[model samples]
Target: MKQTLVIGASLNPSRYSNLAIHRLVQNNIEVKAIGLREGVVTDITIVTDKINFKDIHTITLYLNAKRQVDYYDYIISLQPKRVIFNPGTENPELYKILDENKIHYEQACTLVLLGTNQY
Candidate 1:
């Protein structure tokens, strides 16, 4: 199974990041959630830091562009096969870095991808 790291994950039921967690698990994708807020979703506790991540196949971002700057190095170091910039999370600078690293990137919604059977 492809292991995905859900950046900006939240325990709030109303949040897209939380929804992504549910959707990813439903799709049989393993998920590791990283966020400042700590709580459980579907019996899995959300991790607060990305420093120990390894074998990340994909990273689906839930954070907006401005808040993403501080995480650039962290994300890049994960060396995932791809990064999905869902909706409001798009960043050209980050895209450039991913491009330089030969990492695949897509600016699209994770929900849409799951709904469309493209995830």
Candidate 2:
């Protein structure tokens, strides 16, 4: 499986981002995480900055719309096959920009997708 970057990842176990990481890993999916704090989620390292991740087939967002604004350019630069606007991260402006760049995207739940084997 190609890599999936989890933006807005959290070290907090209760967070959906945290749960997603464990699920992704268990499903044998490669996951790269970006969070406010640098830490480890199981074997995955959560970095605090944009590090130009490569071969990223999917980017699953965990940030809210406003917070996501800061990553618009960075996300576009990654050129992932698709961006998953998970729950609270949906942004219309970013969607337009992605459309202009010809990047595929969807507004859905990452965990749901993975759980259903539809990811």
Candidate 3:
């Protein structure tokens, strides 16, 4: 299982980000949830500090494209092999940057991919 980092994770069960975290765990994928707020998801701590991230294979975003500018550098620094845009997160500028850095990415829903066994 690839270690996935869920950016913009939330504790609120109503949120899609939280549902994605649950789905990620259900699929047996190792996950590290990161968000500005602090809370737990799937019995795992939602990390806030960027310094704690390592060995990340994928980064599935839950944040909107407009809120992503500040994270461009931090995300690139993590150097994940791929980053999934996850529905409303699609950003052309970020995609361009990811391409330039040779990082693979896709604009799709993580839950759908997992459910369809295409993740």
For model 3, give the RMSD to the true fold: 1.0
Highest-TM-score candidate: 2
TM-score of each: 0.95, 0.98, 0.95
Q: Per-model C-alpha lDDT, please?
A: 0.89, 0.95, 0.90
User: Candidate 2 clashing pairs?
Assistant: none
* Number of the predicted model whose lDDT against the real structure is largest: 2
lDDT of 1 by residue, 11-50 (tens): 8999999999999888888889988888888866798866
Total backbone collisions for each predicted model: 0, 0, 0
Off by over 4 Å in 1: none
Q: What is the clash tally of candidate 3?
A: 0
**Descending-lDDT candidate ranking:** 2, 3, 1
Candidate 3: regions farther than 4 A off: none
TM-score for candidate 1: 0.95
Where is the poorest 10-residue window by lDDT in model 3?
A: 44-53
